[model samples]
Target: MPTLIRPFGALLLLLLLCPLAFAQPLPGVIASLAERAPWSDPLEALGTLSADESVTLSATVTKTVAEINFADGEQVERGRLLIRLEDGEEQALLRAAEALSAERANVLGRVSQLQDRNLAARADVEDRQAQLDQARAQAQAQQARLANYRIRAPFSGRVGFREVSVGTLVTPGTALVTLDKLDVMKLDFSVPEVFLGRLSPGLALSATSVAFPDEVFSGEIATLGTRIDPVTRNIEVRALIDNPGLRLRPGLLMEVIVQQRLRDTVVVPEAALEPSGDRHYVMVVHEEGDDHRLEQRSVMIGERRHGEVEVLEGLDEGELVVVHGLQLARDGLAVRLLGVMDDHTGVREILEAHR
Candidate 1:
């Protein structure tokens, strides 16, 4: 063969043997990735907002309201006067009883002097003493009834709707008002009764309310209902959160996330896996027949976080798992070698800068 022909043949052989080694590379596109991390048990649910401290206010006496010291939905201090009633008649009775008791005391003293001189019968002295005791008892009773006319707040809280107005005749058993202390709010949620044993007071949780979508509130496992709701088959639980501004109101809907347990399962980006009915699967690149090929792998998913999923099996650490472009990849499909895509750098930078 001629020298030029021989050189051309040698180059052709090199091309056939190393197709990937010598071709002008296609544009280096960013390859997607699925990074594995330690999986943790995630708990999530929806709930309703409630005040950690809530109570009702009611009238304690039967009388016509003389004065209303508070307006509806106002904050009140503990022991602050809230309502006043007619007390002039009761006050007069108390005063008259006191004068009569004073007169009875003087009579008892005279009777004691007569008895000491043996001029009065013992029975007579006893009768006068009994009369003085009855007068004093009547005076004490009148004072108690009069004191009840003035109603005061039992605690510092935000009052609810007013059932009656000034000059409204109210009785002892009337529904007066409601008080809600919202400084520290509570969230009432429910979980399947099967998890009842796992719940306890003081468990930490994170919650959100529609009123403040941007903020996350901290709370704790405050209480759990003793009996499950038979119709719902769910166990009611409550969490307490500090709300200094009283922005959280009772009966408002909320979302709650609780840390149920700790786990060490494999975690991957949610994009890496595809759901197939009950089972989940992902694509992984592996060496097959002297060439790199994509293989379909079935993985058992446990929990989810953002765009991530927990892989209970079928994945290992340090192994590359396609993230974004996996839907386009097929089993045994040849993929041109590109660099692994890393989206975590931005997250790390943000956290580092914050620190």
Candidate 2:
């Protein structure tokens, strides 16, 4: 009976030690130490994209469209003829003016010759010269009137769909088509008046559109408003973006980011942050002798970029933060440090690989 009790006691001891065996330190958790670095404060705002120049092509005179020189949505250079209107009457008037001017010029020359020969009075020569000048003025006016019948592009740009076809009669201000210089884009956005001190021309900016989520466009501030809007207390700002690819169009909405200033601050990998409701926290590794443990730390975060975040407070430089295996981290729980992540690889790639 004593032998049987000894065996039972040994079995009880083995069952009690099993829990301790299973509680050994967790191995290979990705981590990195916090470090101080330059952090740029970014101001974000929404902006609208516009062309460098845009206008609606229209005829100045009411007349039938004699010829359409451009197809719908054609790219044209400056002074390229787009439309020609019927100019029969205007052309006839111009011819008549030219003929009258030539006749007056001849009479003036004859009168001058007669005056030289002492056959005509000086008053008569002066009157003939005045008549010639009047005729020339009328001819110039007629020429200008005839020019209105032809419409040409004022600048190099892409034309929109044609509103009037050949033989279509159009009047002044009639809708013809839109023309826009799309090689360069203008971005207009408003920022709060408080940022006025930091605002200036030539500041670098970056923009992103919802249509192209993965792409970013770079530009610079081109203009600033003189007066702030009283109602919103915001000032308007314009930026010029080069669109050599011709991807951005007028009226496209974009998110604008302006880097205002930079300062040295504590930062950590983005994966170290653990969100709880509206609060953020991180797991800090504590080293004591041969044992490594975790300490739950609440961190105040600031600017974020790429795969890193700025730690405003609650963390010190050189403190190791768990960048992976957050679900297994607990306060005072033993863990094994696999290695330190010193590179700039994004958090998503790390997580994807680990998972």
- Scored by lDDT, the top model is 2
Cα RMSD of predicted structure 1? 6.6
What lDDT tens digits, residue by residue, belong to model 2 across residues 207-313?
A: 99998899999998999999999999999999999896787899999999987775799999888999999889999998889778899989899878988999999
lDDT values, one for every candidate: 0.77, 0.89
Clash totals for all candidate models: 2, 0
Model 1 alpha-carbon miss at residue 285, Å: 13
Residue range 102-208, candidate 1, lDDT tens digits: 99999999999999999999998999999999999999998888878877787788888878787888887887778888888878889988777667788778888
- Let me know the TM-score candidate 2 reaches against the reference structure: 0.71
Instruction: Estimate TM-scores for all models.
Output: 0.65, 0.71
Candidate 1 local lDDT, residue 324: 43
Model 2 misplaced stretches (Cα beyond 4 Å): 1-39, 262-268, 271-302, 310-355
Off by over 4 Å in 1: 1-45, 53-56, 60-62, 101-133, 263-301, 311-355
Q: Report the Cα lDDT for residue 221, model 1.
A: 89
Give the Cα error of residue 257 in candidate 1, in Å: 3.3
Q: Which candidate leads in TM-score? A: 2
